[model samples]
Target chain A: MILHGYFRSSAAWRVRIALGLKGLTARQVSRHLRKGEQAAPDHLALNPQGLVPTLEVAGQGALTQSLAVLEWLDETQPGPRLLPADAWGRARVRALAQIIACDIHPIQNLRVLQYLKREMGQEQPAIDAWARHWIATGLAAFEARLAEPAAGRFCHGDVPGMADLCLVPQLGNARRFGCDLSPYPRILAVEAACRALPAFMAAAPEAQPDAE
Target chain B: MILHGYFRSSAAWRVRIALGLKGLTARQVSRHLRKGEQAAPDHLALNPQGLVPTLEVAGQGALTQSLAVLEWLDETQPGPRLLPADAWGRARVRALAQIIACDIHPIQNLRVLQYLKREMGQEQPAIDAWARHWIATGLAAFEARLAEPAAGRFCHGDVPGMADLCLVPQLGNARRFGCDLSPYPRILAVEAACRALPAFMAAAPEAQPDAE
Candidate 1:
């Protein structure tokens, strides 16, 4: 498999964590997002959205979307399950993951930030504030959800699953944006637990082959 | 079951379509998003994200996130499957759905536009343009994906499933934003097919009780 990704992309990072957890190895092809390499013809052909983390499977073709790729990996590959076995538990975990993937990360990704700068005529400080505002708002909600009875050592029960995959990468983005993380103690606790795992450690942005 | 939702929220609309597809009825409790009713204490208690389309299942607690709700219904309910039976087909459907859900919709939702106007001090025209830009970008990608062989009358195969559910509502948003639809023939074709379905017609935003 060939994973087209950027080292610092939270979406790509989620897939990296999933790969490590599944004990699967894929050759990495970095599409430096800051340089707009993801928009090149080849990448766009593989992933029409021109997004990072397109997983090119041997016979199945390229799989776009990080969550979908994660789901596919869990369904087909042997691994520690990224989602719980039960229906309701799966719903809870997926909802938690979407809290980050759908709500938070989309609003503050590199392309959106670029639009704020180049198109909206926003200054660096304003752009930074924008990123921080969304991150803090989403994390507060995530923290509240973590206080629910279903949450345990991870985002769901004692296992690190899909939600945890999302949470850890988002927390990475939160720190980079200089957002205050003190308010999300539960999220932080989950992050600490994920940090203790070798799979999570190996998937960190700085640990990637293409990292600056 | 009860659905806490606002009539025009694309995310909530996705859930409504899923419910219709599943032949399930949920009592609608309108949380007026325009009036900031979604942020009220009661709504927040059920959904910490303060987002719409929280499906309150009897004895199952609130299921937040429209995709999660849709998946739960498909898994547990005795109706048409929202996802495909095969793993690869499911991944394709999901990745196509995320093109709208994760990338386009969040960037142009009410709160983000409100932030643009209130926080960034953008004019109404600029805000509308921002909405149009993201919609066009996402739909172009979506159109490209739709051109793939897997796309039949609906987003995948002849059945109107999860990807179609997301596409229909997002097209509503795109038209509202005045985006040029000429660029996406495949998307428009799929929308036409969905429009022919009774399930899709009933779930239209204007067909809802609180549409005013």
Candidate 2:
């Protein structure tokens, strides 16, 4: 498999964590998102959305969307399960993941930030504030969910699963945007547990081959 | 089961369509988004994010996030599968869905629009243009994906699955924002296929009791 990704993309980071957790190796091809390489014709053929990380499988075609790729890995690959075996537990884990993937990340991603500056004539500080605002909002909700009985060493129960994969990357974005993380102690605790794992360690943005 | 949702919320409409497709029924409770009822304490207790389409199951508590709720219903409910049995197909369908769910919808949802107006002090025309820009961008990608060999009558195969559920409602948003649909013939064809079904018809925003 060849994973088309960027070093600092939270979505790509989620896929990297999933690959490590599944004990699967994929050749990396960096699409420098800041340079708009993802929008190039060849990359667009693989992923119409022009987004990182598109997982190009050997027999199967390219798989776009980080969550979908994560699910595909957990389903087909032999490794630690990224989701729970139970139905409701799977739902809870997925919902937690979506809080980051759907609600938080997309609204404040690089493209949107670019739009704010170039299209809307917003200054850098306001754009940063915009990023911080959405991240803070989503994380507060995520923190509240972590306080639920279902949450344990990870986002769901004692095992780190799909939600943890999403949360750790999102927290990286939050910290980068200078969003205060003190309000999310439960999230911090989960992050601490996840960071202790070799899989999580190997998948950090700074550890990536393309990291600056 | 009880669904706490607003009439015109595209996310809620996705859940409604899923329920209809699965031949299941959930009692509807309107949380008027325009009135800020979603952020009320009662709704927030059910969904920490205070978002609509909170599916309150009998014993399993509330399920948040439209995609998660749809997955849960597909996993547990006795109906036509919302996802394909094969891992690759599932991933493709899911990736298509996430093109809207993650990349498109959240970027231009009601709250985000409110923030553009109230917080960022953007004029309505600019906000409308912003919404149209994203809708057009995402739909173009979606259209490109549909042109692939894998796409049949619906997003993945001959059946309307998760991606179709996401697509139809997102089209509603696109039209509302005056996005040019002519650019996406494939998307429009799929939407037509989905709309022809009684399930999709019943789940339309205007078909709901809470629709103004």
Candidate 3:
């Protein structure tokens, strides 16, 4: 298998954590997101969405979307599952992941920020505010969710699953943007627990080979 | 089964289509998003994410996130599967859905648009442009992906499943924003094909009881 990604891409980071938890390895190919490599013909052929973390398995073809890739990995591979056993538990975990992935992460992606600058002409301070505003609001809700009885040491059960994978990366981005973490106690604690696990640590953007 | 959702929420609309496709009915309750009913304490307790399209099965707990809820629906209920049988096919279909759900739809959501106004002080035209911009770009990629041999009448092989469920709502939003659709011919064709279906038509926002 081969993984096509850009280092700072949170979606790709999620896939890396899932693979690490599953103890799977694939050759890494970095597409410089800032350099517009993802939109190039070669990359678009792999993923028409022109996004990072397109995983090309030996036979299963190039898989885009980090969560979908994680699900496929969970289905095909054997090891620590990245989700809960019961259907309801899985739903809770997914809702947590989507809180970050769908609500927080998408709004602050690099391309969107660039568009804010180049197209919309949003000033730097305004853009940064936009980014921090979303991260803070979304994380607050996620932090509240983590305080629920269903939350164990990780985002769901004791095991680090899909929700944990998503939370860690978004928090990593939060810290990157200098967003205040003090408000989200539960999310902060979960991030700390996730950091203790080698899988989440290994998937951090700065820990990757392509990190700047 | 019951679904707590707003009639106009694209996220909820996806679940409505899925339920129809599976020959199932969710006892519906509308938390009018336009009226800020989703932020109510009762709704928040059921779904921590505070987003709509929370599916409550009689025996199982509530499921959130349109994609995850759709997957659980596919898994538990015996009917037309929302995902493809093969792994590669599933990946493709999922990628298609995420391009809309994870990429296009979230940024243009009512809350986010409201944020651009209340917090960022972005004027209406600027906010509308932001909405159109993301939808147009995301749909362009979606159109190219559909050009692949994999796309039949629906986003995948002729059946309307997860991807189709995602696509129609987005196109509806695009039309609402008065976005130019000529650039995405294949996407427009797929939207037309999906709109013709009774399942899609019945699930439309305008057809809902609280559409006003």
What value does the lDDT take at residue B85 in candidate 2?
Answer: 92
Tens digit of lDDT per residue, candidate 3, span B109-207?
Answer: 998899878877789999999999999889988988898899998899898889999999888899899999998888878888988888888899988
CAPRI quality band, candidate 1: high
- In candidate 2, residue B91 scores what lDDT? 94
Order of models, best lDDT first: 2, 1, 3
TM-score of every model? 0.99, 0.99, 0.96
As for lDDT, the candidate ahead, 1 or 3, is 1
Task: Considering only chain B, report the TM-score of model 2.
Answer: 0.99
List each candidate's DockQ score: 0.92, 0.94, 0.70
lDDT of 1 by residue, B1-212 (tens): 99999889999999998888888899999999989899999999999998898999998799999999988999999989999999999999999899999999999999999999999999999999999999999999899888889999989999899999999999999989899899899999999999998888998989999989
How far in Å is the alpha carbon of A98 misplaced in model 2? 0.1
1 versus 3: better TM-score goes to: 1
Whole-model lDDT per candidate: 0.94, 0.94, 0.87
Per model, kept true contacts as a fraction are 0.88, 0.92, 0.68
Where is model 2 more than 4 Å wrong at Cα? none
